[model samples]
Target chain A: MRAMVYRGPYKVRVEEKDIPAIEHPNDAIIRVTRAAICGSDLHLYHGMMPDTRVGTTFGHEFIGVVEKVGGSVHSLSPGDRVMVPFNVYCGSCYFCARGLYSNCHNVNPNATAVGGIYGYSHTTGGYDGGQAEYVRVPFADVGPSLIPDWLDDEDALLMTDALATGYFGAQLGDIVEGDTVVVFGAGPVGLFAAKSAWLMGAGRVIVIDQLEYRLEKARTFAHAETFNYNEYDDIVVEMKKTTDYLGADVVIDAVGAEADGNFLQHVTAAKLKLQGGSPIALNWAIDAVRKGGNVSVVGAYGPIFSAVKFGDAVNKGLTLRMNQCPVKRQWPRLLEHIRNGHLKPNDIVTHRIPLEHIAEGYHMFSAKLDNCIKPLIVPNAR
Target chain B: MPSTPYVSNKPKNTETREELRARIPGWGADLDPADRPSYPKERLDPSATGAHWDFPERQAGAEGREHSIEHEIVPPVFGTSVPLKGFSGAIRRHAYASYSEGRAAHWLLLILGDRVDAWESHLRSLASLRPDNPVTETGVLSERRRHGIASRFGVKRSDINHQWIDPLIVGAPWVAAGGAAVVVVRKLVRRR
Candidate 1:
């Protein structure tokens, strides 16, 4: 199997490796047909997430065909098309029994303290990610969502991570009928979060991002109002003006742990380190939320941990919920929405590169070139 | 030129000073070193002067399943109790111990024990009873200090070393025996 191996910090290379076979009775081997670079993967590319082992295949978002399955995997069989979730979970466990599948105890026995996420670093579980040619899918019966024949690859890909993350964000925000929601960052997850809020009957959805293309896409495809943080000298004031000075009922920070933006654009960039999704946006969301409002965080909080202004959350009496969503829980509903034509998350795909050009895709996506939001990498590239 | 003051020689309650003396014994024995019938090394300890260290018998039934008992030391208000009354001896009817509540308390205590000082402080601040500060009994904290253990000086309970509560409580021999209370106060003093 020729797979893209994470060599070292900020370096990924296409390497030849043996195809993984099912080692456990619950395992299944999937012939990965389509895999994409996740926004979280960019964190790995830029050296933000350094815990990913060198030479480990680094991708968790994919749509694949089950080539083989162990005896225990009765629910899924060969030739079934599926969307794999980012986290591998055993259906049985204290957390799993309570429907908190992300923190499933049986997934990674070694690093068994916190939740286990696929394709993440050793701290998560050293499970080789799905970015390779043929990847081993653990807890196959629980992890993979069986895609119906009607849905295309693009639609299925969204369900794997981005769409699920967005739905998870909306779920966390508790988006109900007529609720006004504001989402930070118009990246893939943010857009999906906005989309989910719309589907959940949000009265108004506003997306905040600096990129002109992403902001425009959020308005056009995801049905969100837009705010470019770069344009407004005071984003809080700008967002407040839209919400009648009461602030939004719900604010979702899809950006997690973004370093300050230093991109020769604004003076604020100097302190922020990067012009991307960040925890500062979380602080902003807290400030921009109404009293008793909800704040849902679906952003990938990288390995970096720092101080946060929790007093703002406390002062506002805000209900803040954060977790790595169990995609399997939401995938079925998202797939139904996709099939019904009520949801079209595939419109976020701006670039589709071959698996060989994954490195190039990473560069373009990180640089925010060519209106890229979610770039799909067709590994087989037929 | 200075004469040392007289020091009292009371056997201070050194209960929480958990010492790992016994290695995991072969098959049949009480897990706790303190509860063991007797170890040869107990004769050599300076503190064991005239104190017969009677270790409990390793209670193993002939069928080979070893049975051991452990008492969870919870606050009396929180602890489960069986009322036996009439001011006279009667048939003692025992109550079934709920493992679920015990498990919950066990986890809660593990988490609470991690910041016992903060909990102690909070309890003191909230309670109507303004308990007096601990009389710094010199021998209790200082004997270990005289032996040059840095951990002996820290009054903050979180600063004390503890393994993951599960393995130590379940697999290891020691059992939690009893409880104690202390007081802490916050004050601002003017420095001359």
Candidate 2:
């Protein structure tokens, strides 16, 4: 099998690796048809994540065909197409029982913070990712859902993480009717967050980013107001200015560790390794939302102390909600949204790179070179 | 002061929905209220938020906190917990100084620092008579008593795949530490 192997930061190569066999009865071998290089993958690619060992493949969002299944796997068989959620969780864990699949206690022996995630480094369970010709999907009964006959393969791939996570971010906001929602970051997740905010009865949606291209996507795709934070003297002040000086009712921080607005925060957190991640966007979220408002954070941050505004949050009585998206939990409503033409998850996809050229794909996305909003990987592409 | 043009019910651009649809593929798919699931809840009224201030008062105590090299000043408020310290702090400082976050060395060093910090905590705990327990902390006891082994054998468990490794990875460190302690005690006893 040909897989993308990590050779330190900013270096990945396609190398032949063994086709993984099912070591567990619930495991299934997937012949990956589509995979995506997520913005979070840039964390692994840039060596931001701890224990992202050399030779580990870096992909979590993928959909594929069931090439084989273990004896205990009854829900799927060979030749069935499935969309695998990023979480590798048991269906019956304490957390899983309550629909908190992302925090399943049984899957990851590495940490208790998050459940097993495919190819997200050893810190999230060192299971190899699907950025290859084939991948071993564990807990196949729980994680992989058969691709709906009406859904496109591209849409199914995006739903595995980006789309579902975006909706989850909005869901966390608890937006009421006519509430103003501001999203920080115009990445795929951010775009989806903005889009999902409107579906949750937000009166207005605003997306902020440094990039012009993504802001354009926010305007066109999400039909939300867009702001280039680089253009403003203080983006938070600008956020308040637009929301009647009360601040937005809800703010979502979709930009995680490598946020660009603050030079010092980015340098210390991202460059210096002082903090787990840059809290610039999250800090901005706390400041930009109205008092007693909601702040939904879906951005990927490492498990280290960030300089968050804990005092202000307490003083203002802000409801700060965050978690890794329980992708499967959001699927029912999201599937309905997609069926109703409310969301076209793949519309944000700008580039399709073959598995062989994934190194180039990572470089392009990481460098922000080609207006690449969402890049999909065709694993078996000729 | 006049409000920003963006804080209006009207679309920001002059282009109509049809025009946007023409230019961008699949645009305006959710434009109609009938098509939207939450249309009944969406009032599209942006003027109702009862806000009195032009700018909120800034929170105090943001001085002298760690910030990225890119900012001129810290945000109005920032967290003041868990300032970096100890030998692990030195390793982290070196990691920041030596390599860009884009390099694998930076993160590897950070992970190494975390391990060092864990050991430091363990040593501190030992002095406090509240030492870390490998058995309970690692959930090894749960496997014996809480149907952990029973759950993995016959049921469909992804973790069963890596069960072979769970012991060596978890137990080896403790075994090595125990052996080291035994050797030290033997030397002390021989001298006495």
Candidate 3:
């Protein structure tokens, strides 16, 4: 089988590798049809994540056909089309019992923080990702769902991570009727966060980004007010002014570790690696939300000390909610949203690169070239 | 006209179930509770979990598996993927066997093992027809062609601080390996 083998930072190439076989009775081998390059994959691509070893594949969002299943797998059979969540979790764990599948304790040896994520670094349990011709899915009964006949393959692929995460970000916000919600970053997650805010009864949605192209996407796809932070000297003041000087009722920090607004913060966190990730966006979230308001974080941050404004958050009486989205937990409502034309996740897909050209795909995405928003990998493309 | 607020008692979608079925392909396929795979689990019946014993039967072949020193016995179910092997595996086993999980030494050793495992993969790839290409794969060429240097100078790239050491980190091993290989070939030629 041909898979995307990681060589080093800023490098990945197509290489021949053995097809993954089921190691456990609960396992299934999926023949990947559609995979996506997530924004978080950039951390691994840039060597920002610890233990992102060479020869590992990087992809967490994918949908595929079940080529083979172990004897214990009964919900799915050979040839069953499925969308596997990025999480690899046991269905009956304490966390899974409470619908917190992302925190499943039984799957990862590093169960202290996060559960298993496919194709992430060893920090996320070292499971090979779906950015290949085939992948091994553990606890297949728990993580994968049959792609609804009405759902497009690309939509299912997006649901594996991006769309579900955005929706989960909004869900965490606990938005009330007529609340003003502000989202930082206009990437796929931010765009979906703004759109989901409307579904959750936010009176107004605002998206902030420095990139004009992504801001344009926020305006069109999310149908929210857009802000080019580069245009304003103080974007947080502008946010407050727009929200009638009370700050937004809720703020979503969709930009994580690699945020690039403040020079000092970006330098210490991103350049010098002094902190886990640049906390500029998160600090903005804490500062821009109204007192006693909800601040939701869906951004990926390393487990290290970030210079967050904990004092300000305490004084202002804010609720800070965040976690890795339990992707499967969001599917039921998201499926309904898709069926009703409330969301078209595939609409954000701008590029469909074959798996062979993944190196170029990573380069383009990391460089922010050619107005690429989301790039989907077709592993079986001819 | 303003859009209907989703929080209102009224259904957000005005379309009837029959209409949605007609409009969207396979729209209601899993609408039936029985058709959903998770429906049984949704009942939250503890008795239906199918586990008759207090604890699950221990999986076979747990003897050589590395477990944290904190654990008296390995957990009932643990990941078997990427089983420990090679010199890196020995380091990992030592880390697990010697130190507590809370110690930085344990984590640091594991990270070292990971780096060693990566080098092992790279050395193994060298023996294959397609050896790892340091220049293109390391993206050193992009610094020249893609304004990589210029981008670094003014940009807030987190990686820029350590850019000077990147070449040494990526190239030193390959250079050393090449020099070693040349020395071996020269000795063989001299003997001939």
Candidate 4:
């Protein structure tokens, strides 16, 4: 199997490797029909994560066909088309019962009492990831979402991770009607988070990022209010002015470690901080939100120890919610939205390259070239 | 649950005070090789209590009777326990490994039911292992509870042959009821 492998920080390569197989009874093997590079993948590729090995396959967001299943598996079978979430989870565990599948105990059996995840880490359970021709899925019943015939793989692919993460960020943000939602980093996840907030009835949706291209893309495609961080010397002040001199009701930190911001600064400044870098947007959100507001982080960060500010969070009575990705909870609803024509996340795919040119796609996406927003790797066809 | 004396059946061996100190180096110093203990075959008995601690019993073919030395403590598998508050009804509760020790211990209490007293005793015994100060005891208990401290006496003690220990506190009756008098106390500690 040919898969994209990470060579170094900001270096990725398309190389040949053995095809992944079903290792556990609840496992299933999926043939990658369509896969895309997510912001989280960039974290691993850029060496932001510690202990990320070179030559490990780099991909978590994908949709594929079931090629095989273990004897204990009953929810899915071969020939079924499914969208596999980046994080594998057992549907029957305590976390799963609460729809917190990303923290499933059986998925990353190698982790600290938490099971493994594909492409995550040794601390995260060291499962072989899905960026290849074939990917192994643990706890197949909960992780794989069956795609409706009306939905194409590209459209349903977001259900795997990106769209689900976005929706989860919005849901975690608790974007009630008439609330103003602001999302930092208008990357694919942030864009989806903004769109999900808009769908969930946020009166005004604002997105902030350093990339003017991404900010423009969110504004033009999703009708989101935009702020380019480079344009404003004081981002917090700018975001506050945009929200009637008040902060956002909810802020989604879509930019995890891959974000080129001072993580230590965020830990010291933001009271209720998320892992990874000090999300520059979180500082703005802390200044922007009402006395009692929420902040949802759906960014990719390693499991190694990180610091947070508790005093600021307590003072403002802010609620902080973060997770790997709530693919299990929101994937079904996202697929329904896609089937109903209410969501068109495929529009985020500004570049679609043949899988043969995966190496080039990685370079272009990393460089943010050719108006690239979300790039998809079509394995069989262009 | 009472703390069971960690006893083993093996042969007795002769040792000087220095040799005995080296065997259980609870204090972080190296044992002098010249002060090592020895056992002659005539005096060796494989079925005696406390004989396993004798270092020479390991050298004899009676090592099987000797308890394996390095015991790795497996942390507890914590389930969810919500504060019952004024209402005793069982609401849908969710547990995570990310929860605090007190929260996890509360869930253990709910599951242990009539055995709560026994479990509390076990926790107290574990607590007794702490220094004399109550403040230090509270801090240690809070840390262990968050991590899910398991008692071999409360449940089955892990064997020397076992690599992993099941820290799950089981046998609690998850029942339904109206209201009960309960109090929830929150404290601050180093966050993970």
List the global CA lDDT of all models: 0.58, 0.72, 0.75, 0.55
Per-residue CA lDDT of model 3 for A1-382, tens digit only, reads 9898787656678888889877767788999999999999987776666556677887899899999997777678999999999888776766666666787666665435777899887667667898999999877767899999989999999999999889878777877656788999899999988888776666678999877778889888887889887678888999877765778888999999878788788766654545668899999999999888999999998655689989999999999988898788678878988887878998899899998778777776776655779999999886
Task: List candidate 4 stretches off by more than 4 Å.
Answer: A113-115, A261-275, A305-310, B1-192
Docking class of 4: incorrect
Give the top-scoring candidate (TM-score).
Answer: 3
> In model 1, what is the error at residue B73, expressed in angstroms?
27
Error of 2 at A329 (Å): 1.1
lDDT ranking, high to low: 3, 2, 1, 4
Candidate 1: TM-score? 0.64
Give the least accurate 10-residue stretch of model 1 chain A, judged by summed lDDT: A264-273
User: Compared with the true structure, what per-residue lDDT tens digits does model 4 show for residues A107-155?
Assistant: 3322333344567533344455666788777667656768878887777
Candidate order by decreasing TM-score: 3, 2, 1, 4
Among all candidates shown, the one with the greatest DockQ:
3
Prediction 4 global C-alpha lDDT: 0.55
**Tens digits of per-residue lDDT for model 3 on B1-192?**
433222323223224555544543334443343433333333443233322333433445567767666555654455443667788878877877887756766666665676687678778878989877765564344344445555445433333444455456567777888899999999999999
lDDT of 2 by residue, A177-211 (tens): 56788999999999998988776666678899877
lDDT of 1 at A85: 83
DockQ of 2: 0.03
